[model samples]
Target: MRELRGPIGVAIALWAVVATLFHLYTAGFGFYEPRSQRSLHLLFLLPLAFVLYPAGASSPKDRPSVLDWGLAALAVAANYYSYAQAFRINLRFENVTPLLWPEIVFGVVATLLVLEALRRAVTPVLAGLLALGILYLFATEYMPGMLNYRDMSFSEIVETMYLLNGMGMYGSITGISATMVAIFIAFGAFVTGSGTGRLFHNLGTRIAGRQSGGPGKVSVISSALFGTISGSSTANVFTTGSFTIPAMMRAGFRPHFAGGVETSSSVGGQIMPPVMGAGAFVMAEITNTPYSSIIVAALLGSLLYFFMILVSVHLEAKRLGLVGCDPSEIPPWREVLKDIHLLAPIFLLLVLLMMGRSPHFAAFWSIVAVLVVSWISPRTRLTPRKLWDVLVQAGNNMVIVALACAGASMLVACLTVTGVVISVSTLVATLADGSILIAGILLMATTLILGMGVPTTAAYIIGASIGAPILIQMGVPVLSAHLFVFYFAILADATPPVSVASYAAASIARSDPMRTGLAAFRLALAGFVVGYSYLYTPALTLQGPVLEIVGQVLVNVLGLVIIAAGLFGYLRSPLPMPLRMLLVPVGLFLTLFEAYSVWLRIPVELAVLAGLAYWPTLLSTPAPVRGETTRRAESAPD
Candidate 1:
């Protein structure tokens, strides 16, 4: 339980800084070949992961034991062993490379290190899952039908997993971390360190604190703005929810509702772009879609998601008869703008991305931009010491993602080796029994399940590898299919039963965990429809003509409104239970953009409009809870 001190803490800090410098150097100056680049990246991260993350939950919190340091050194050395002989390994194109004893020993060590890292950083289930995959690799032929596989020798399995172009540990994902994701994450760290988070929080409070459901709306806005920068959902929650959740409670929201809003909105940051969660970078690489295209395709869905929360908050505010925070209590916009220059780096990054710069390039210069812009204000200035701490924090943040990506790449390699990737897809297709909707549901369920325990990048990487192929087989567009799985994976954090994010927010709000989770799920219902909408009609993903995209968006926007109103039982006034039930199907139908459904939508739209005109008469008089106030202060303050 002793805190890390003296040489060991300094060593760890230096190692992380060295790693950041390595990535910064490669990102700006020149790059290594893919294998070397990624191998070195993994080597840099392996030791840091061991030393930074505890070996177990019961392991030391502040200090590393001798054994822990030794293991950390070993993990780094193993990667260096592969990296040092990259040229010699590359020459052997086939799997017939002779395994020296060191190679064999290190191979086994590398496999164990990856599993241990996964066990430490992610869940034990994922680590066990990788162990099972490796077991399958060596003993597949001994299985029953449908679970059977072609057996490969132990050496062959080792070759494929550890030594084959470093595909297992140093694959596309590792490559992404080395080149693209690390830089963007570093940019995030710099932005946060330079005071952008405070600026955004101030702006959000000033902009949203007095609106309907003021504090909740402030949370939605701040989390969205902040999430766009950090791109990690849980981090987003803890960062902004610490403020927003408390504010919502004071604004009269139930503890559970406040918690649910924070969890749901923070989770939305993963789906937001141009600097989305790390998963977006991997998704762009895996799907062969340009990062810009991915961001463009995601724009509508992300905005609609925020819009849904906004509408729901407004309705709840109306139902509760809540009022905005007193102007005397709220921060003024002018005061918040004092740190406005802190936003230049963010705007620059977004502009460069829109201009089609590669993500790494945009991120590299944005980091510089943050450094440069921080000089403008004495209050936001970054000293060398401060900047060093930023890099260390960046490295610390990158560790979880590095471990997740490494493990994911290993699982990806395993599935590809055992041919299970194709089998799982075929099995999913079979489960669908030819209905694309059924196939979509099965894949959605799978991602959500994996997402319950896995980080977004790992869950999506695994799900897309298995499920996207099945969807493509069913004629779904490549982007739409990957987007579908990715969306559901992000949603998994808010989903009930095993949602870590909901639990995190529940703790903050002092609410029931399961109830918060359900509330989050209710608020996030639009996400499910939107995920499927892109697949049913590609226009939603920016795949079709401009007119088609606009028309489709308008229709779906209305559908989202109807869905939200129904779910919460309020629209201008409280909707009756029967009307609420009626709107669900109508809302769902409005999202199904196929020609056949258009016929149903037309009549449904007319009826909805007619209902709106006569809405006042539909309900019996003495409107329940009309002008109701959730809390009454008995006397005015002196």
Candidate 2:
């Protein structure tokens, strides 16, 4: 994005403040009628997205063009129609309103604007996907196999799409985006602007920067911290990667390896609670589970995912004989931590959430607490200028997310209206026969394919609607199905070719993007496996007794370690090729044991123990290292 000068800058800034204030007011008091609240929500985002993100990279980014102004005015007119006549529209829909030309024109214009805004904010892939949703509605009767359904008329599609609570723009979990996700985005912006992000990075460096794999570990810790709030893997990469990626590279990690570590670690943010990514919010809404419950269930899974990344980087560092950063270069703990109150809002946010406040309530109060806490010290205070930046940044980030939700909702509207979602679910069940495991695998593949190249929240919206229903039909837990799709949706950012997170980190690390993506996928392997773990062992999702949950979780953690050892070719010492191959199935079998009977599990558990006993004996001879990296190699104790 470019810096707008003079009038344009002031105009954008004023609108941004108004939008933030509007949300803050409602969050403090209460929401307007659902339609009124959501329409106004989009009213704020649509115009800003057009002005901030242009038609293309070749267009002016920061300044609005004549076409942009027209889109902005159209956004106001389209959503305003819904806002102004909410009661009338509600009654009309209730009366089974017929096709109207005005509604049709508005819907056509509004849908086109939404698609274009999404194309600019996210990627063109999402815009194209959303456009297909409309086509699907009109073309459903022509679809082959289970996907075929009766088509809807064009006028009906238009009527259903134009309103605040319309099928296309408002329902199917988009409410979570308009409410919880928007507030959280603002909360994140305030936290970041108040310097809490640096505090996280500094704290990470203090804890991990002196280890042999310090830089990589620091990246994991810091990215996880920042990601919980930022929720955008690409944003997290740029924020934390600027420091961590360079530190890793300077600490002797190969550029591609460094970028991969950053990419995978940053993606972990969406899985981390108290604020998991946008997907978690939608999951809570769709599954009808408490947000706290969702977060609790996600806790173990989040740990397992990041723990594997930490272990992979450590093993790689060990195998390659990498070392920590210089002591002189490391920031002193006292200096870095002096203004730690900046993180108080995060703690408060979590506390309020655990206390059963609405997620938006918690987020609102947290933002308030941020404002209050930042006043404690001038160095950390949110000055007026800084606060303005926070509002603008919040509005900017939220627009992208809101637009992504709109695009995803277009699909949800199509699928729900056309009954194609059910057909897809039925098709999967048929393909899998009577086996739940096969059904789950098929759903995972479907979600994984659809999730790639989409935003986390949007990806989950589309993938879960299509995939989660299949698992539910197979009698799997609702939370399990949503969590399953959520995991894959977040993972799509690390998958190769179009791995946006990896590509972002690669640019920062100055590495080959595809190599970084492939390496990220490899490092994130445990995530893929664990997505299935919770399905087989409900204990992993905290569905069982406390002891059983602990036991199951521990077993899965150990299994992840064993798998990482095999894939990364290291533990205490490097494993030879054959041992690496042997360890793979040993890990896989042990994981399966947790979900199997004792008669079968005990034998598998012992087999793993046997490998554990023998691994150290066959350890490969380690090579020596040279240069600055070796200077502080002794800093980390064996």
Candidate 3:
């Protein structure tokens, strides 16, 4: 986060460019051995973390201190030790071979360095988790029954956490970060730098600016589009919410409501298809499912999430008598389409992915495609300077992801080595009393709590490590279980109390963080419903027949619409409080109604909901809005 202006800054910049090029080249061609590949990646990123992120509040802002340089050097040395010893490390059986003093020393340093880097670049919550995992490993033998395992010595723990290739700081999770995650992050950087971000905003305004709840809808559309590449919900909020939140306030929306809309919609982007959040890649790696298939299964559930957000916004706008942007202020469709070529890379990336190409391979070509398409218009072109900026951006972004993954690897190492993962899974299974729903509720709570502190990807990794096993043991499909964990992890960003995305939006909107967070949680409630829905019927994940998928999807959509109407107190017209209260549970019950064929349930549920919605109009005349927001908006136009 420092802004150095001298030779040290230039040196760091050069290192970042080289780091990005390394990943791009490896992605396009082939990777090195797993140990070599992952360790080398840490070598490139770990040093940057120390230099870029200050160690503490008193740390220098303009340049790294001597201690920073020393730490960076240590990171490089420790990772180089791994790179050099990778062959021997690979050949040696984990926990079976005795470690030399030097290996033990370097392993300890590497593990500590990863934890420190993660603390600097990410949340200390995750770092604390990793530290506790290490302590738990040391205290294993003293723990109670079912929580007990053979205690590991310092040297043995070092071997597991660092020297080993597949279960620690240099594990499969880190491998995911170094390879597929890094390449996609680089692709995102290029896409962002290529003027496509501007295109997304413009396209959003063009398409949604004149609709009901136009400004909020614009936030939903732009954030979701940007989320595909950006992946981070808080990043998406800062990127798109800066524009849309102010627009909503100008259009007479309450500050908290505006922030809530942006927060919920931005978080929904992680569940969006194609280039989903980094957690999706981790899910693929952990579940051993194809990335394409995961996205495919996630498609409907993600749509329902956005649909609820959109519907809620619409109903809220209607209830407030909110008006869209003036037609003159909206862009013409043709003008917005002029930069449509910017999307070619994403389309091509999708094509290659559907063709069964490796994710890194697809992302590598997609980066190339971004370069090719960038030259189409002078306004969007990436010159050498811009190219360097792209690389710098990518390297900087990868720091958090790479370190988070390495830290997560360390935690997973402890859990596995201590046999805590299975114990926790068994405990949840027993507590659930063989009920999948109860087991899911337990996992969802854990993921949401964990996600509130760490990045969603790391949360998913940890949640899946603990929760997915329980669901799978209960006979849930592998993909369904992982998706369930993934959804809650993402939704945590919009959940109240500790919602990061909502807080980010609140900063922009100058709203109460708690109020904005509650609003966001309310708007995004459908995501939770979708997660639970898939637990019962994998068809919601597109696992069943086409007709079944369509019918169930229709049913879910209708139910969500009803829920939105009830929550917002509007359906065709504002409902009386009693009707609003009645509609919510009625809607929920209908959503859970799945005994008969979905084909048969759809029309009946539709008729019943329609009767409830219109019944309010028949009971009494609707009241008119006379609020200050409406009066102020009419008196002083934007």
lDDT winner, 1 or 3: 3
In model 1, where do residues sit more than 4 Å from their true spots? 1-7, 596-603, 606-614, 619-638
Candidate models: Cα lDDT each: 0.84, 0.82, 0.89
Question: Per-residue CA lDDT of candidate 2, range 73-109, in tens?
Answer: 9998988876887777666753166855777787798
lDDT of 1 by residue, 450-532 (tens): 99988889899999998988888888999999999999999999999998889999989999999999999988887898899
| Residue 513 in candidate 3, Cα distance off native in Å | 0.8
lDDT tens digits by residue: candidate 3, 1-638: 88867888888999999999999999988999999999899999999999999999999999998998999999999999889988888889777899988898888888888888888989899999999988888889999988799757888888888887778988999999999999999999999999887889889888888987788888888888999888889889998888889999988789999999999988988899889999999999888899999889999998898989989988999999998877876888787877899999999999999999999999999999999988988888999999999999899999999988888888888888788888898889899999987898899999999999999988999999999988887888999899999999999999978998998999999999999999999999999889988777889888878888888889889988888888899878777788778777877777865666777767867897777667856677667566966887789957
- Winning candidate number (TM-score): 3
Q: After superposition, how far is residue 483 of candidate 3 from its true place, in Å?
A: 0.3
Shift in Å, residue 91, candidate 3: 0.9
In model 1, pairs of residues that clash are none
TM-score of each model, paired residue for residue: 0.94, 0.93, 0.95
Error of 1 at 562 (Å): 1.2
In model 3, residue pairs whose N, Cα or C atoms come closer than 3 Å (at least 3 residues apart or on different chains), thus clashing, are none
